[model samples]
Each structure stands twice: as C-alpha cells, then as structure tokens.
Target: DTAVSQTPKYLVTQMGNDKSIKCEQNLGHDTMYWYKQDSKKFLKIMFSYNNKELIINETVPNRFSPKSPDKAHLNLHINSLELGDSAVYFCASSQGGQGGDTQYFGPGTRLTVL
Candidate 1:
C-alpha cells in the first residue's frame, strides 16, 4: 500500500483557472506537508499541518492555499494559476519529534499552467 497518494498525478491547465490537488496518507502520521519542486529540483516547503491543524506556512502566494480536513487528508487549492505555478507538487508526511520525522514523498502531482 502506498504511504501517501496524490490525485491527478498530472494537471495541465491554462492561466487564470482554478485547480485543486488532493492528498492522503495512510501512514497515520501526525504531520503532513505540501512541497513544490521546480525545474532545478529544489524542494521548498509550502505548508505543513499537524493533527489537522496548520503549523507551518511558508511565505507562498495568496493564490495557493492548503486545507487539511483530517489527520490523513490534506488538499491544495490554487486560484488564478499562473505560469510560475507550473511545477511538481509533492505530498509528504512524518511522525515528528520521535526520531520518526523522516519525510516520505508521494509520486508527485505535476501541474502545468500555460
């Protein structure tokens, strides 16, 4: 079974459109995160939630928002998707603070905005 999974592994859409990406983790981790990877393969943390509560919010654009409905599910919503938003989105989760914080990444959602 996959520890983490993100729906619509690839998303291609035009600018000014709204889109959403869904994610879930079966590992029962307390902390989950959203990460953006650019062409250079640099991964930046976008948001992180612990136990269904927001904990870390990177200084991302207002157009990007993340929601965690439960401990196991976190979804991302983007409004007016811009070309700069064309990057791979990765969903990850960790147990945190117990020597179990090693992040496990999903297959990734590739979003392309034209």
Candidate 2:
C-alpha cells in the first residue's frame, strides 16, 4: 500500500483559474503538510495540519488554503492561480508534529500555469 497518494499528478492550466489537489495518506500520521517547490527547487512549507487543526506558514499567501478532513488527508486549494505558482506541490506526513520526525512525501503534483 502506498503510504501517501495524490490525485492528478500533473496539472496544466491558464492563469486566473482555480484548482485543487487532493492528497491521502495511510501512514497514520498526526501531522500532514503542503509544501511548494519553486522552479529553483526550493521547497517551503505552505501549511500544516495537526489533528485536523491548521497551522499556516506566515510566508504563504492568503490565496493558498489547506484543509485536512482527518489525520490521513490534506488537500490544497489555490485561488486565482498565478504564473509563479507553477511548481511541484508535495504532500507529506510525519508521525509527530516535530522537527526530527521522518516525513514521507507523496509524488508531487506538477502545476503549470500558462
């Protein structure tokens, strides 16, 4: 069984469009996160959910929203997609919401905005 899974692994859309990516994990982790990998390959945490409570990274834009229905799922919704938003979005999960815990990542969702 896959520890983590994401739907629509690739997304191609025009700017100003809205899109959402769904992620599910069977790892039974307490914390799940949404990370955005920029074109330069810099990965930054956008949001994290611990036990269904959200903790948004301050640097992330208000347009980016993360929702966790339960401990095993985290979904990302992007409003008014921008060209700069094109990057690989990774969904990750860790046993505990702490810095040293191993985070297992799912196959990235590559979003390309034209």
Candidate 3:
C-alpha cells in the first residue's frame, strides 16, 4: 500500500483557472506538509500542519491554500492560478514535530498553467 498518495498525477489548465489536489497518508503521521518544486528544481515548503497548528510560508501566494480535514489528509487548493503556478506539488507526512522526522512523499502532482 502507498503510504502517501495524491490524485491527478498530472494537471493542465489555463491561467485564472482553479484547481485542487488531494493527498492522503496511511502512515499515521501527525504532521503533514505541502511543497512546491519549480522548473529550476528548487523545492520550498508551502505549508506545514502539526497538532492543529498551521505554518504558512511567507513566500507562498494567497492564491494557494492548504486544507486538512484530519491528521491523515492534506489538500492543496489553488485559486486564480497563474502561469507561475506551474510546478510539481508534493504532499508529505512525518511522524512527529516539524523537525527530524522522516517524511514520506507522494508521487507528486504536476500542474501546468498556460
């Protein structure tokens, strides 16, 4: 069984469109995060959720939102998507705090905004 899973492995949409990516982890981890990898291959954390506290990266745009209905799930919703929004979005989970725990990553959802 996949420890972490994400839907719509690939997505293509026009600028200004809205999209969402669903993520779930079976590892029973208490912490979940969303990361975005740009074309340059630089990965940056968009949001982190732990113990009901959410930490949002300042660099992330307001158009991006992270929603967690429970500990095992985290979803990314992008509104008014722009060309710069095209990237690989990865969902990850860790056992403990945001620190040293090993994170399991999902396959990733590639979003292309034209």
Candidate 4:
C-alpha cells in the first residue's frame, strides 16, 4: 500500500476555474502538510495540520484552503485559480508537528492553469 497518495495527479484547467486535490496517508502520522513547488523547483509550505488542527499558514492567499478531515488525510482546494497557482502540489506527513521530523511527501499533483 502507498504510504502517501494523491488523487488526479495531473490537472489542466483555465485560469478562473476552481480545482481540488485530495491526499491520503496510511503512515498513521498525526501531522500533515501541503506544499507548492513552482516551475523553478522552489518549494514552499502552504499549510500544515497537526491532529486535525491548523498549525502553519505561510502567507497563502485566502483562495487557497487546506482541509484535514483526519490526521491521515489532507486536501487542498484552490478557488479562482490563477496562472501563478499552476504548480506541483505535494502532500506530506510526519510523525509529529516538529521542525526536525522527517516528512514523507506524496508523488505530487501537477496543476496547469492555461
């Protein structure tokens, strides 16, 4: 079984369309996070949840939301998608909500806004 899985690995849509990417982890971790990697391969943390509670919000736009139904699942929703939003969204999990914890990342969902 996959430790971390994400649905719809590739998403192609218009600039104004809304889209969502779902993620699930079987690692039984209590912390999950969402990261965006731009075309230049710059990675940035968008959101993080620990025990189903928001722990980090890195100046992300209001249109971007991260929802964790439980400790093992984290989904990302983007409203009014823009060209800048086109990037690889990665789902990750760690043993706990700590800076030194090793994070396992999903394959990532590539979003393209045309």
Candidate 1 differs from the real structure by a C-alpha RMSD in angstroms, to one decimal, of 1.2
Q: In angstroms, how far off is 83's CA in candidate 2?
A: 0.5
Candidate 4 per-residue lDDT, tens place, 52-98, comes to 99999999999998898888899999999999898999999999987
Q: Which of 2 and 3 is ahead in lDDT?
A: 2
Q: What is the model-wide C-alpha lDDT for candidate 1? A: 0.93
Distance from true location, Cα of 35 in model 4, Å: 0.7
TM-score for each candidate, following the candidate numbering: 0.95, 0.95, 0.94, 0.97
Model 2 spans with C-alpha error above 4 angstroms: none
lDDT against true structure, model 3: 0.90
- How would you encode candidate 1's per-residue C-alpha lDDT over 1-114 as one tens digit per residue? 989999989999999999999999999888899999998999999999999888888999989989999999999999999999999999999987247469989999999999
lDDT of each: 0.93, 0.91, 0.90, 0.94
TM-score of structure candidate 3: 0.94
Residue 110 accuracy (lDDT) in model 3: 96
> Which pairs of residues clash in candidate 4, taking residues 3 or more apart in a chain or in different chains?
none
Most accurate candidate by TM-score? 4
After TM-score superposition, the amount by which residue 46's alpha carbon in candidate 2 deviates from its true location, in angstroms, is 0.8
Question: By TM-score, is 1 or 4 better?
Answer: 4
Q: State which candidate, 2 or 4, has the greater lDDT.
A: 4
